[model samples]
Target: MTARTPARTPRRTLRLPSWLPVDGYVLALLGTVGLAALLPASGAAAHVAEGAATGAVAFLFFLYGARLSTREALDGLRHWRLHLTVLGSTFLLFPLLGLAARGLVPTVLTPQLYSGFLFLCLVPSTIQSSIAFTSIARGNVPAAICAGSFSSLAGIVLTPLLAALLLGNSAGGLSADALLRIVLQLLVPFLAGQFLRRWVGGFLARHKKVLGYVDRGSILLVVYTAFSQGMVAGIRHLVTPARLGLLLAVEAVLLAAMLTLTWYGSRRLGFDRADRIAIQFAGSKKSLAAGLPMASVLFGPQASLAVLPLMLFHQMQLMVCAVLAKRRAHDGADTAETGGAPSVGRITPMTAPR
Candidate 1:
């Protein structure tokens, strides 16, 4: 009895505060940006990095094609209206808002920054975070998954066409060369992956965790290469602290507007609580992962600045949506307790998408 177990010390692990829920991947992105600023590739190394980034972009799309299940996507098409609403919000409403913001240029935002801002609006909605948030909020998670996949597939073609039409020469124009690059770098690889998926899919599933890292690593390499080119081109001076603050403020307004529209607007359109949640999360956010590679291809050396607005927006959406998801879950629980219509779907643990 005297030799009883010694008082146990509770192990303490480091964690970010709930109020500041930053994703670890985002931190790695910031670090890669810093690395580019400090020691940018040049001369032969620049060419090498550029080549590697091009290859990485192709590989990334290949992975995207392999991971997406054709049958699931077709199955999701049965929820046609919800998917259409999300697409409208993503491609139509978001771009309209972005164009409306053009009035702020040369005052709140430089021409270059404005181009980037518009491009941010044109990119597809995220898949992983959209599903995660929808699940957390007790939304129609399957709808979210299909909506996101459709948007991404549509974006591969639409984004480039829109950029050529809107951004014009800033995005290397809509010439045959540009079209060929889009097909070769993005579409062809994706098709190849889809074709080979029967054989490679099993391997990919077995090493999903490892391949996820590879996916992220490829994007990081692309960022480093793009930022390195920007550094070499001496474009850093364009982004002053004051300009950055202004950009952040403009982006805050943009995010708030989308969130509000996607929620209330969906309700008015007859979507239920669960469908509305999926629409809001899927429609309101852009994919940094998809946008980055596309920017690198479209904007060339100016890719650095082109991706800046998107990068900031990505982090902003993550933080804001995380809080919103938790609140939504709480509201759903309260509704069930009061004998009201509970959320449509069961809440599931968040899983990383292939």
Candidate 2:
């Protein structure tokens, strides 16, 4: 009765990294935009840079094709509901928002920038970040894979079509040449990558890091080119800091609104929590990859100005979504503690259309 050991103290700690929240990426993207504004590249060097960036974009997609496994792609196909949710958000929801925001022309945003805004709505959902945030939130990783793939695949066709139909005049009146350009320069190469995947897929997956460099480097070139054009054309004057801030605020509201609708709407539509999370993350993002090249091709000398809105929104979505994904994780800690997990995380790459 006399010998009683002192009770041990329990460690108290919070996992800071686990709580990074999707909004963090929004800030990061904003910072990136600010940096781009500060230095906005210029001159003939910019053209060379732009050429290099275009090459990079094709290569990046090729690597995307290589990294995806056929088996995983089939597995992802099994989760059709999740995929549709993302598609609905990308194609349906985003376009609606773009239409609603049209009243902002010449006040908060210019018509050309508004065209860029509309284009961002039509572009595909992001692949890497969508899968990544879904994984972090302990959501449906396979669903994320399929949903993201579906979005990208559909965007290749749908974006151009929807633009022609809804945003035809806005998108420079969609000439036969422009339609041909989408089919030839964009879709054709992507499909080619998918067909050749069997041969180089293994090599790509093994060397993803190296290829990622190729990807980032290419985007950098596009960035320089787009900015240089803007600098040459005096497009910056149209997008003052105040207007830029207003655009971000508008985009943030747009992002939050879409995320909320997709998440809760999916639940109401009878999707499970895991599927809802995947849908929300996958559906809400805009593909910077798709947007940049399409802008370059569609808007001509004004492509940079046309792409500026999207460039801003891309970073905004990433940062805001990053923070949101993490928050959802913490909020769902109780569910995790209850020992329920639909599946462990796994992200499969999507095939690029050649």
Candidate 3:
């Protein structure tokens, strides 16, 4: 038999692909952002819409609580390395970038967009999407699940605190009141779900698809409300194509810097290749779904522009990471094919459910 090494992807391809491609959800997100850029809304109607949007944001967090599995939490215990990597990336590396980017204000990116750019770095990683991609790529599904979950849990506190510390003066004078609001709006609901986890758990598993729609819809509503506020606030007048191009370049650098840091940092910390991949992918991605709603709450109408850099970076990460993930998979295949070692990713665990 010809000696063929197994394939392992670069630590990069560990995240989902749609994040990189012009997929449906991303396109939908861009459409909403573009709509806001073109037609900003105002008046008492805007106020009412904002109120509704705020309520939806709280409810979305509540549902997040209710949907997460108690059973899975137990399984997550086994993947500590993967989970820690994701959390560090989300809470530690992401915030540092947000802080560093602040020095660029009025030079490359406008002050307002720069604040938004910083806030983008403050949000959590995506859960469903990350896990979904990891599973599809035949990476460690359990580790992906746990890692994504841990990042979200940490973000409930970290994202708000980081924003307060890093983007305070820039985020329209963020108040302690906003911190309390985040706790009440996001943390409380999530805790409640944990409290009621046993009862709500089954309900969510059964209605996962329906709940997914609820989650996406809630985000869309948040976008509409925030865009309406931006319209009322005239944020559109401040952003220009040149400034946006500059923002993209800066964000590109930031994403690349982060990807390099997290991937190598974890390896230096002695994580295996699987874990290193998870860290690089999960750490590098900023959640538009999580950030958009939080940005609305934290930055109010100005959130429309603030989240723009994040939105763009979110897509950029998706594209770059998709290619990387595939390359990693192929690398694994080649490694097994060449080395004659049975590829770990392709081997089904005897314990796995049939």
Candidate 4:
């Protein structure tokens, strides 16, 4: 009986490969979109959702203002060159590349899709993901933090201006009414948070985890309202599977170009590995959190189509950067171990940051 006892088999849990990280928030956004597609808000319901979305967006910005530490931002200014490089990559190089892609219109991308793509380029770099990736790769965390913060702050002003200039009538022409809405909905709340940060900063710190949910929930509400409007308007018919495939291909190229440029370009500029990692992650990615609300405000009813490229690109970047960050971390580890040149192509275990 003892000899007949069978050995227990270990259970194998199915998991996605490290190179392909699926973000749960992206899943939530897609689910929200599905809900909008199925049960779109219309008439009175639409009006209420729109109002709630607007108020949510304002409160989101207020939280942004409250959470950002002023002293840290001021100290980050000390690393001005690195910050400038990130800004130039985000605002200048990205826009130029987007402009060049206009040559593909009518051939590779529809006008509406192109507008979305260009808008994606004009949006700012991410803060949390940049910091998270930089930390994962053992890079200059403070610089990543500062660069992302500056890019986000700059984006609050620059994105609307850039949209008005680049997107023209497609972005509602940024009329006085649009500008006032931007100020009232985004800028004012942010400034209010900054003003009250001294009083509420501690509270935000304590409730950081809870407020994070609030942030994502607010964005999801904005998305639902935008998509519901789009559905009601029958804008879903505009995108075919063929167009989506082509758009994804174009976005892949765009992402590859940015990643390459940020990495090697920083190296040529004489940055060390850590700073280079910070620059690559910070400079190559766009912020979904910031871009979504801006799209809702700027594009109005057309926001659903306008944000499609950004939403797709956000997920794409997360997956690619997860693999890249792992490789980077492995290289960092090798450099430390060998006391010589860093290795490449080897992946280390890394949990993707949300």
| TM-scores, each model vs. reference | 0.95, 0.81, 0.86, 0.94
RMSD of 2: 7.2
For model 3, how does the per-residue alpha-carbon lDDT over 110-170 read when each residue is reduced to its tens digit? 8888788878877888775565545444466667777777777778778877877777765
Q: Give candidates' CA RMSD values in order.
A: 2.1, 7.2, 9.1, 2.8
Where does candidate 1 stray beyond 4 Å? 1-14, 343-354
Stretch of 10 with least lDDT, candidate 2: 345-354
Model 2 lDDT tens row, 1-354 = 699999989988865453233343334444544555677655576666666766665665555555556567677777776777778889999999999999887788878778778888888888777878887777877788778877877877888788777767656566888887666656777777788888877777788778766665556566556666666777767777887788788888888899889888998999877788889988888887667776665665677667777877776676677677767776666565678654444333221111
Candidate 4 lDDT over residue span 152-254, tens digit each: 9999899989998999998988689888999999899999999999999999999989988999999999999999999999977889999999999999999
Task: Work out candidate 1's RMSD over C-alphas.
Answer: 2.1
- CA lDDT of each candidate? 0.91, 0.72, 0.74, 0.91
> Candidate 1, residue 133: CA error in Å?
0.6
lDDT of 1 by residue, 115-218 (tens): 99999999999999999999988888899999999999889888888888889988999889988889999999999988989989999999999999999999
lDDT score at residue 328, model 1, on the 0-100 scale: 88
